[model samples]
Target: MAIQKQEFIERMKRLQASVRLSELEAFLVTAQDSIFYLTGVTYSPLERPFFILVRPDTGVVLLAPTLDRDHLASAPNVDEVRAYWDYPSPPGLGWSDGLLELVAGIRLLGVEPSLTQEIAQVISAWQPQAVPLIERLRLVKSADEVAMLRQAASYADLGMQKIIQAAYYGVSEIEIFSQGRAVQIQIIKETEFDPLNTSVLTAAWPARLGTQPHGVPSIADRLKDGPHIGLSFLRANGYAAECERTFFVTSPSQNMSEMFTLMLEARNRAFALIRPGVPCAEIDRAANGFLRQEGLGDYLLHRTGHGFGLGNHEGPWVAEGSPDVLEENMLISVEPGLYIPGLGGFRHSDTVLVTSDGYESLTRYPTEIEALTLLARRSMTRLRGALVRKAVGVA
Candidate 1:
């Protein structure tokens, strides 16, 4: 079943209670996810421009060009839908004027920084003291929010299963993307789940020597054979489960194989450490420790993972200097990768939900060395050419 309107209203009530504003008086949410979260509305109306205006105590308002008004009207929680003609744009105070008028008398106003510059300027002109309220409210996920994320992970698992079965030699990278995309669409149609847009497929090589983090190849190029390649995908809701595994087009060299194994161990160790009260920084260090022991420490890249929810990337990033404590209901990724120049890259990533005592992995693709080797064998020579280009001596 779809999220209830009453749930949304209750969320607003909580937001209202926190701010001590009987209602926000007015909150103009420009971030698409924020709009969806607050109003339970989901649609891409603004081909070029669109915005959501909410009066926490009063009602909801939608502003868009005439072309999209009909579609925007269907969004949940929208009470007064205002449409502005496109071709013959309204006079002096056209669409903006209507938006301005919608909240003309409101004293307190809130806005998301991601909102268009023009809209922010308008909101500033009307209420110079608008509060930065959106992020604070969105930073934490509720129970309904957790359920949505879990459902997205469920779909992602299904999509990955379909892609794994089809991942083979001679299939173009585009073909893999197509396969993953089709599976997601099919899942959406069959499960009646929310629409998803996320990293559905990937094939990336580590930088040179397979030892230096700085070694790199431009992803703009198409998929090729040789060095190690990694693939990660997600069947997204507003939230998603992101899982990744490396595959070799041919037998991985001894070093390449070892690197993959180490990365997997790091990820598993990190996963085991996940529980309420664990420090986020400690988790990053734990994974980084594995790379250090292997003498590939410098080549390690990015954070262990990050919070996944309404938006693909969220807060509580798993990295050094993080002050976040692992909390129940939090969903994140534990991906530790090793990238070296001249050699390809190795990474094993999975989405996980923190629990009271332990953690639950959302993306459970085969991470074992033998299983990965078989997948690489199935991929065949597509990886060789790519690896040869990265390393001068590879045959």
Candidate 2:
């Protein structure tokens, strides 16, 4: 999906502004994500390298392989666009030949860290810049980026809803995973959004049975565990968000209810602390501290959350001792998890936009107890109730 002409212009302008201030004549972007962020083009980087050169006076130049030229056909801010037949140019030159030749005369060049060593060697003096220009610029969201993120989050929520609806005692993990992916794909098609990527996971048990934290669901694996976890992560173009919920294969025991209640409380506590100018570390501490107070600290595994946008896991991590500070319009996840060696991992995550004053949740899948009950009968009854309510116009 190509970014609007005006959005592309604004982005290049920002790059130019940064370049001018740094006394750099041009910015060389080699990172795939960086190029996608600046020009709304993505392809198989392995087959062919893509480069976006941004000059203070020349706007932007995109050098891509012929195979991916159509992705940039409608992109704006590209003052000059060129394409090579394939890598290892016909003249026996290297992959960096075309891009290096384009910016050969640049006195001082700005670069993203993803620049290959060979590419840097072609330049006169490759003094690496401190922070990646594109990543720094992407730390804050424009109105358009926020809109894309909102759309991605909506699809994630819808996928999660479908997952719980499909939950059953005998259902195979692969079955639910397929259904969830299909629903998200359907949403993208119906909404006229471009084809995107999604991850749907179903966990039948905790580490108690040596269940790996991350796994691909197998057709043979069924949801026979008392409770299972369903995680939905969706990406729209490059933007993405994640939502996770716990499902019970049968009626949850009193202890399971209590543990989940604690997890929800931890997630909420962390959510309340998100805002512009706050130290990102405190957010993690808030959740971690609460979990400790409830005697669940020992079960902590990863950080509270991480900033997300073009990259699912980016800067401003909500982890203990992190130095980054939160900023307005920064997208973050509030996923506080507790993993007991035998019981299972307890985690509930929601993507939120750090706003000017506070924060706004983007994912709105049902987190309440009634909706997450995995008991075959109870869940089916609720699903029927939802359908009935919709039919009666009172859902």
Candidate 3:
């Protein structure tokens, strides 16, 4: 379900309250996600700038390009809508002019840390305070946001199922990736989902290529008798979730099995630490310490995980050196990995929600090695994948 209009209004109220407490005359929100959080409005500003000005007593005003004036009419909780001709216009009619006029009498202005330097220079005279008021508010998911994330997680699970079903001995990475995409397209066509806010992406990092944790999938890299990683990341409506797994077309060697076991254990350790009020860094430390003690520290790559919502990767980072603490309703991913050059990567990721007492795994695909191992034989999805690859001219 989409976030209700009332929720958006409540968010604006909270932001305005924060602005007043900070002693700022006005708060300018430039981040796209922050604007969406405040007013249920989505836009791809690209080079054109968009602003949401929140005043203590004046309510909310949106400064948008003239092209979007009509489109934004349906936006809820906005007290006023002002427009500029475009990005670069006559000195009196551009975005800068509109912005300056909006805050002309304000002595103190608060801006999001995401504001671009050029825009910052434009209002340098105000010496805008870079406050993370909106970001901090976003850290804890509302009941509505959690519902959207659950929907997104279900789609991610479906995509992962398609990916695993399509995998076979000679299947190329792109072929497997295409099968997941086809399912996503079909879902959008048949459901009430907003295509602009929904996306599903899959990748297969086969064999040695999996060592490059962030490597792009290649058509030439086919599944083999070794560890392979599959990733299914999607956002339904405005919320995001991810599901990833490490699988093998054939039985993994004993050593590879051992590595997978360690990786899973590390993830479990992190999961056991999730609860309201726990320091985010402690979760990472417990997981990292486990791997380091197992003599696999050299193979460790990135952080244990990170929070996700409107943006795929956001605040309340679940990593060493992070200052944020876990709070109820915060959604985070738990992924601890070990990447060995020739042996491939061993990692599994799931979107998890921090609950009052513990956590809930939203993307509940089979994580055990037995369930992940794909039989190297023909299947309907494999045949469909082959047809898709041929249609796309991928030999």
Candidate 4:
């Protein structure tokens, strides 16, 4: 099971109990993601709103359109399912009225910020005296929650390895991307979590010969030479993981040999500093500090990394200005990238969990840039040989 029923009730209790919300008997949860976070039943990211009424002291009550009831019931930790009717079914004769009836005695109602205005207005009119409660109490994660995040991170690592394996001479960036999707699907299925979304490599070299790889060309663009660049955008169980590395289609350049070493070192520096109780901003500073000292500060692009779980990105940002403090169960990515404008960039990212003592690197894939460069070189050599054969045949 994704999450246990008792676990969800416990989570809900934790949420309400944290803020001394005993007076709030029922919380109106409209955010679908929160519903999944609390219920562990994530079907789809639909526009249709779902509601969960919880009386921290009591239990959970779910409301959605009639069509979604069966699937919602299948969710691991959900109970007391209710639904509203659409089409020819009578209007205003559904879960809305039941929801209103359910919370009759509740004076304090909790809601997420993303609640639709229409729902808010109706809710307010129904209970004019009820105070609205904000469910922003979900920032911190528990140990179990961190485990699921670690699982998702593992899937991402597998996907990267699959990309490396599929990369070879004459293969287009799109082909590598296809292989990545297959790997993502396989990993998610093994974990029994629904696949959210996946994006693989953009291994195109620039039109100019001898220039570094990372350029955002049109989809129709072709590699001027070899050394195809690889990028993958993957989401495992709705948690997003992005990774990119440059590969030589045949042979790695002399510069690539040195850049790969620096990339791996920078990644290691960031990983070693990640620990529970550390300030989130300091994580970025620590990683950036190393790059700056190496005189490669100008090559850095994005922040050190971002938190991951449930949704692709979440709390405890690994960027500057993030005052969020790391906790034992919080999961985040420790990625550092060196992107030179005209030259290609190199980056290594892995999802990690903060532990009681220190941290756990969920991903075990080797991010040593040299290995990837060598892989690129081998692929490029094969492509060059094939091209030469074709030309000779035509002549």
Best by TM-score: 3
Residue 16 alpha-carbon offset, candidate 1, angstroms: 2.8
Candidate 2 lDDT over 1-395, as tens digits, reads 32466886688788888888778878888887777677664455886777777778765778887767777755666767778778766773545667667777677677877777666776746564534778778888888789878877887787787777776666555555555656556655755465533343323432233224465555445565544667777676567888888767667778777888888998888988888989988998899889998887677778898988887788768898888899999999998877766566677788899999999999998887778776655565446544544554442
lDDT at 352, model 1? 85
227-254 per-residue lDDT for model 1 (tens digits): 4454445545456566666765456778
- Candidates sorted by lDDT, best first: 3, 2, 1, 4
Error of 1 at 360 (Å): 0.5
Candidate 1, RMSD to the unseen true structure: 5.6
- The lDDT values for all models are 0.64, 0.73, 0.87, 0.62
- Candidate 4, residue 180: Cα displacement in angstroms equals 2.7
Higher-TM-score candidate among 3 and 4?
3
Q: Higher TM-score: candidate 2 or 4?
A: 2
Please identify model 4 stretches exceeding 4 Å from their true place: 19-26, 74-79, 87-91, 94-108, 117-147, 193-229, 237-246, 250-262, 292-299, 375-395
Weakest 10 consecutive residues of candidate 1 by summed lDDT:
205-214
Q: What is the TM-score of each predicted model, taking all chains together?
A: 0.79, 0.85, 0.96, 0.75
- Candidate 1 ranges with C-alpha deviation above 4 Å: 21-25, 54-57, 67-79, 105-108, 126-132, 168-171, 193-227, 235-237, 375-395
Clashes counted in candidate 3 amount to 0
lDDT of 1: 0.64
Which pairs clash inside model 3?
none
The TM-score measured for candidate 2 stands at 0.85
